[model samples]
Target chain A: MANSVTAAKATRGINKTIIYIVCIGLAVLSILPFWIMFVNATRSTAEIQSGLSLLPSTHLKTNWDVLTSKSFDPLKGFLNSFIISASSTALSVYFSALTAYGLVVYNWKWRQAFFTFILCVMLIPTQASAIGFYKFMYQLHLNNSFLPLILPAIAAPAMVFFMRQYLLSTLSLEIVEASRIDGSGEFATFNRIILPLMTPALATQAIFAFVASWNNLFMPLILLTDKSKYTLPIMVSLLRGDIYKTEFGSIYMGLALTALPLFVIYFLLSRYIIAGVALGGVKE
Target chain B: MRRKGTINYAKYGYIFSIPFVLVFLVFALYPTLYTAFIGFTDMKGVIPKPVHILDNPFQNFKELIFDNASFRQSLSNTFILWITNFIPQIALALLLTAWFTNQRLNIKGQGMFKVLLYMPNIITASTIAVLFSTLFAFPMGPVNSLFDALGWSDAPIQFLQQKNTARGIVSFIQFWMWYGNTMIILIAGVMGINPALFEAAAIDGASGFQTFFRVTLPSLRTIMLFTLITSMVGGLQMFDIPQLFITPAGGPDNATLTTSVFIYGQAFKGAYMYNKAAAASMIMFVIAAALAALMFYLMRDRSEGQLRKKLRAQKKAAKAAARGM
Candidate 1:
């Protein structure tokens, strides 16, 4: 009986290990595209088309040069992406955090109604109004500018929801009461005391908003038409082809350039991504 | 927070909320209401647009939902596509979550794995579409090379050129993008469970499978429903991948045309069909609203029932304890 039990335990251990390996191996397949993208970026397009090269190649600089040259205007595109994403992030975090703070901490008329409005739009995917929004922008005569892209981030409902979660964990009504006793105005207290307390949470949501705005393609695609105003990815795609199909190396180089910000951001702030995603999904 | 000496609290409160109201009015509320208003007109996409009277969108709505065969076909295809995409997304997320929770996975860097999987999400869709374009290009891509190595096929296959193939690959990409998100949520949900209950199950000689079935799934009922419903709402809006796949040609044989894409194509991409586009968008909005309502209704019912059961169990246990005392 002892022998049989011991054998069963060993078998179970082996099976658990196998399951773990298999599951994580499947997860690796999830990131395979990024790996492939990196590989393609490093090699010459000819070498890429020919076969998979396991290691980084020396041709990266030439590819980098073409990508960064005046024709690409890589800096301008990066600057454009940066300006849009940063503005969106600042607007989204400020507005959403304020609304979230009001909803959670204050006693306001229609608070329940306001909350219901927030909840209703929570899961309504962007697709529902995507076309409508595009046409609306066209008529508003704002389609050509970045305002159409950056303005919407201010009312980002998800950011509001995320802020609510963060504030719930970090803030207390007592703190507000104390601030009030100290003769601090509500906004002043919120801006100074609450904002300081909420910094970590703010960072998380800000990163999320930044990444989201940075990655926004469909809206920008349908809204912005001019080549001069294109974000990095948009500019890159235009480089590869809009009038004519170009060389694969330039396009691959363009892809590498476009994807670089996200890669760097990911490496720098990976911890917050998990928290932001989980916070949104937690309640539901 | 308005205590006896708190200085000018109301003024500050109002000040902080201005940016939010400004943005909401300019962006979300304005566009949404304007879209619905436009739906009432027969206006197409350009200036001096054809208006067929505001009161009657019946014809346009009818064309979008039932009368036009292509619209109807895309609708059916979208339904099929949503189900196919969501199945693998939810399934893989659940499996990954369970593995992450398992003591034996012994994974050295679990958080790193999650972050890596989620990396694709940050890249622009154009970049993703472009990456996929190269990865599966005819005669030259690595996927074809792998097929060649396996002797599965002698010739190259243009995966995105054909009708069903294009839809399949597009759906596959959506599934790939969403799974990492769902998996992370499920991981957090699983981690939120009471470890004591799981330990109790183990002491009773219950296997991992039994514990998951008896404890984990039930506890995660709300979250699972949430994932499923949101996926249905969002997955049906397949536009980008299909558009890029069949780009430079409005879609191969129109097989890759999504409803949003079709509406967009009409309104701007091709000849402006504003009234038709607006009508289609209205119909699309109605369907989405209905689906969202239905999910919420169902989810509320399930949770309410579960809540009742939990209350009853607690009441019974309390009574038994009182009697014993």
Candidate 2:
């Protein structure tokens, strides 16, 4: 009995070892694309086409020069993206939170009906609205300005839904009742008391709004005619092949420039991000 | 608790949400409605209902269905794009979720890893297009290189050049971008499961597969269905990636031209013909509404006793396994 048990235990150990190997293998597989992108940034285009560059190369400066080419103006594009994203975020958070507060704290006869209407709108994909958006902007001559890119992003249906759930979960009726009894105006109490209390939720919503606005390539692509008004993603794609994709250092720099701010903001406010996601789930 | 009074907050709340609703109405609902109204007309460039869009407004739709050669090919391409992208997305996501959820595998740093995987989603429009355009290149791209290295074939594959191939490659990039998000949601569902149920199953000597089937899956039925439904709805409206490639006056022979992209081309670039474009948008809206209804039906069980029946099945399956059936 002892001999048989020993053999079974030994086999279990071997099986676990194999599982560990496979897990790490899959993990590496998951990150391989990122690594390839980073490494390829360093090598020459010739090297990349001939074969995969498993190792990172040292042609960093050359890639940088090409990335900052006169036509692309990567920095200017980044700044433009920042300006558009910032304005959009400020608008989205304030309005979405206000809308949520208005709905939850105050009541109306058609409240349920209107709220359902918004929920239905959320199901309509961005593509479904692309034509009207383009034409509407054109009619107003807003196509040239950054407002076309920034304005629509502010009124995200998902953000309103998220804010509503947050208000429902966190805000207490008693507190609102007291504020009202103490003679604070509805909007006044919201601005003074509720907004102050809802800092964390606002911060994360701002992060999402910011990222959405920043990474929005399509609106800018279609609306902005001049090269000077482009965002980073559009700038990167418009990056001609004369520059090259293989030069590792410059491409990584571009990736970092575009993605890092988002990563930092998300990581810093990750707690709120998770909470916001969980907030939606709680409703279900 | 006393009932509260209605405060007529629509005046305030409606004002707050007006921007979104207005945008939706003006650009979305109006254009979609207008396009459908125009589909029957011969509207095109700056013309009333019957003017020309860059090409012909009704011609494309009419030709899509009735014209001899164009009808079959266009419909075939449409189905090809919808399916080639649609099917693999769900399949990969399910498999990846199952893989990641295997607790015995003991994935290290799962949270950080998941967040990293989800990075692609933040890259909404332009970035995804650039990333894929670069990745799916002919001879030089890494994907073809990998296929070659694996001895799948000797020569470089022109994935985006051929009609069917372009659809699949586009779908693959989209699949990579989407599956991570789906997995994150599924992981959330997995995390929400009552651990005690899992422990109880372990105590009964159930294998990993059995425990997953009997406990994890049944509990996740709703969330899983939600994932499936949303993916399908989202798949139908795919436009950005195709549109990005639709530039320089050429794009893969319009093989990758999605319904949304095709509609946009009709209205804006094709001829600024909103009415015919309106028709296409209406078709999409109807499809989306139908799918949503289908989703709701799938999510809700037919009756209250269905839950009891599911539990009974679990018990029966467990007993049968114990009896070595």
Candidate 3:
């Protein structure tokens, strides 16, 4: 019995070691591409073409200069992306919360029906309406404008669904009643009392919305034809197509720049993002 | 005083709901209907023109379904790519989730591992696509140079030029980017299972594998179904990577031409066939709606419905017995 127990313990240790090795191996694989991209960004086109180096080189300044001199402007792209993502995220989160609050608070007729309608809306993929939306925007003279891109976010059904689910579990009616009793207007109560209560959900949804909007290539690619108004993804895409001007270092630099903000955001709020995904899965 | 006390506050709900409702009507609902309408009309070009309803209402749809080789190839390619990526993705995700969630293994630094794994997903897909394209650049790329140095090949491989390899790389990228996300969701599902179930399985002399199969997998049915349907829906809309990975878009021979890419090409690219694109979009929308409906049907509480049926039957039987007595 004693011999068998020792053998079992030894086997257990072996299994744990194997598991750790596999986990670490995958983690490395996950990060290897990004590492190569960053490393390549620092090396010149010739060095990058010659071979792969795991180490960062001294050509970062040169690459940045090369990148800036090209039609692809990282700073402008970043500014454009920031403007779109920030405005859309703000609209998506705030309005979603308000809509969810509306669904939850008042014992109104058509509440359940409206919630179901929103849920149905969630099932429709955005790509399905791309052509018509493009045409409609063109007809309205809203194409090439940020208003069409940002305004549609106000009706983000998935965000509304998430917010509604969050409110259903966390919101208490007594607070709304209390605010009402104290003569606070409905909108004021929502802005003051309710928005604070939804800070956690709002933050999680805001991050998701921001990332999504930032990474959105389809709409902007179709809508914005002007080079000056191009977002980061579009700039990266432009770099891909410019084979004659293939400065590998500068191109990699552009890709890295496009991904840098996301990396920073992910690193800072990974805990919340992961938790949000997990929660989203469970709720689904 | 009674009237003041009886003030109806329901209007507040409508007031708050108006913004969302109006936005949805203008943006979501109207666009969808307009797309459907466009599918039936002959609207094409960069400049706006009066759209004429097709003589046969199904002219674009019939032509696309029957005649258009490119659209059909795109449809098949989309499925092929999605399946190739999804199979490996779910397999790796399940394996990782099993390892991570195993109580016996009790993996350390799971948080750090998860963070690293999910890192790729947060980056822009366009950037990721371009990064991979550069990494696998022909003749003098890092991949080619590495192969040359290692004596793996006599000549540099034209990765993007070849159809199969290009599709494979695209599939690999998709798998790499998403497997971690799937694993995270699966881990959450596993965590949600009651510990008592595992304890009971252990008491029954079940091994770790047996416990996972019996307790974990059984309990994860709902979440797994959710994952599967959502992944399917998302897969149907796959666009960015395939679009930006190669020049002239859609890689060599259009091997990576997804349905979305096809739609994009129709409306935005050569010839600007807005009506045809709308028709394709409508088809995709219909398929997606069907899948969602199927998911809802599968996810319904069948056991509860059965239990209610049984209760009603029992009530009828009890009443009949009383009447007989």
Candidate 4:
């Protein structure tokens, strides 16, 4: 028995070491592409063409010059993307919460049906409706405008569904009743009491909403034809197509610049983001 | 004196729901119906004209199903890419989740590992595609240089210029980007299983593999179904990377052209066949809806269903006794 126990212990130790090695290897695999992109961003075109290096060089300023000298301006792209993502995220989170509250608080006949409708709406992919949406926007001359992009976010069905699930678990109808007894209006109660109660859900959903909007390339690619109004993804795509194709260092720099904001955001709020994904997964 | 009664707050529901309802009607519902409607019409070109309903409403559908080689190829490509990536992705995710959530092998620094692993997912697909393209650039790129240094090949391989290599890279990118997400989700699922079941398994002398297969896997039915359905739906809509990765959008004989890319090309590129694009969208919608329906069927509450059946049988017996009385 003693010999068997020691054998098992030794096997377990070996297994643990193997698991750690695999885990570390995967971690490196995950970050290697980003590291390579950043390192290549700092290297000259010739250097990049010659070979890959794990170390950074001093050609970043030169690459930046090449990037800006072209039609694709990273700063302007950042501003455009920020404007679109911020507006959409704010609208989506607030409106979704409001809709969830509306569904939950009031004892209405159509409440269940409306909630079911929203659930169904959540399954409908955006790409399914793109053709008609594009045509309709074009007909209304809403193309090349951010209105089509930002305003439609007010009806984010998936976010509403998530918020509804959140409210179902956390919200107490007693609070709404208490506020009503205290002479508070329904909307006022929602704004003050309910919104505050939903801060955690709001923040989590807001991060997801912001990231999704920031990374959105399909709708914007089709809708916004004007270069001045181009978002970062579109700008990065253009860099691939134009004469900047041969400028390898600048191309890498542009790619890095596009991904940098997301990296910064992820590093800052990674705990929340990972937690949010886990939470979202659990509800299903 | 007012009678004690509950206030009628039914109208408040409608009042509060007005914005969501209105926006849903205009933006979401309307656009979907419009797509369906235009699918039956003969609309094309950049100019917006009066869309006349085709004599055969299924003309575009019939043509696409029967005649359109590119659409068929794209549909197959979409499935191939999704299946190739999804199989490996789920395998790796399940393996990692098992390890991460293992009770005996409590891994340290899981948080840092998770953050790093999930980093690739947050980056824009367009940018990732471009980065990969440059990394594997023809003749004198990072990948080629590495191969040369290692003496792997006599000549540099044109990674993107070839059909299979292009498809493989796209599939690999999809796999790399999504495995972390799948792992996180599965970890949540594993974490949610009742500790009692695990304890029961342990007490019964169940090995770790046996416990996972019996106790953990069975308990994760709902969450597993959720992940599968969502991934399926998302996979069907794969577009950004394939479109932006190569020039001429779905190049090298269109080996990487997906259903969404096909629809996009029809609507926006070349002749601007909006009707055809709408038709393809409707087809994809049907496919997605079918998958969702399958999920719902699989995820239906079996206990509730059995309870309802028992209640109905009990009610029948009660009715029979009352008739006898």
**Which window of 10 residues has the lowest lDDT sum in candidate 1 chain B?**
B1-10
The superposed Cα distance between candidate 3 and the true structure at residue A34, in angstroms, equals 0.8
Model 4: docking quality category: medium
Each model's fraction of native contacts: 0.50, 0.28, 0.85, 0.77
Clashes of 3: 0
Instruction: Score each candidate by Cα lDDT.
Output: 0.73, 0.66, 0.90, 0.90
Error of 1 at B2 (Å): 14
Instruction: Write down the DockQ of candidate 3.
Output: 0.78
User: For model 1, what fraction of the real interface contacts is kept?
Assistant: 0.50
- Give per-residue CA lDDT, model 3, range B1-325, as digits (tens): 3457766989988999999999989998899999999999999987778889999999999999999998999999999999999999998898888888888788889999999998889999999998889889988888898899999999999999999999999999999999989999999999888889988998999998898788888899998898899999999999999999987788699999999999999999888999999999999999999998898788876754685598579769978987787
* TM-scores for candidates 1 onward, in order: 0.88, 0.80, 0.95, 0.95
Q: Which candidate gets the maximum DockQ versus the true structure? A: 3
Is candidate 1 or 2 superior in lDDT? 1
How many backbone clashes can be found in candidate 4?
0
Candidate 1: list runs displaced more than 4 Å: A61-72, A239-246, B1-18, B45-55, B104-108, B248-250, B298-325
* Consecutive 10-residue window with the lowest summed lDDT within model 3 chain A: A237-246
Question: In model 4, how large is the Cα lDDT of residue A57?
Answer: 98
- The digit string of per-residue lDDT tens for model 2 on A81-186 reads 8899899899878878887887787555566676777666766766555555666677688876898776666457778888887898799989887987798977
Q: Candidate 4 has which clashing residue pairs, if any? A: none
Any idea what lDDT model 3 has?
A: 0.90
* Candidate 2 C-alpha error for residue A150, in Å: 2.4
Model 2 / residue A225 / CA error / Å: 1.7
TM-score of chain A, all candidates: 0.88, 0.83, 0.97, 0.98
lDDT score at residue B107, model 3, on the 0-100 scale: 84
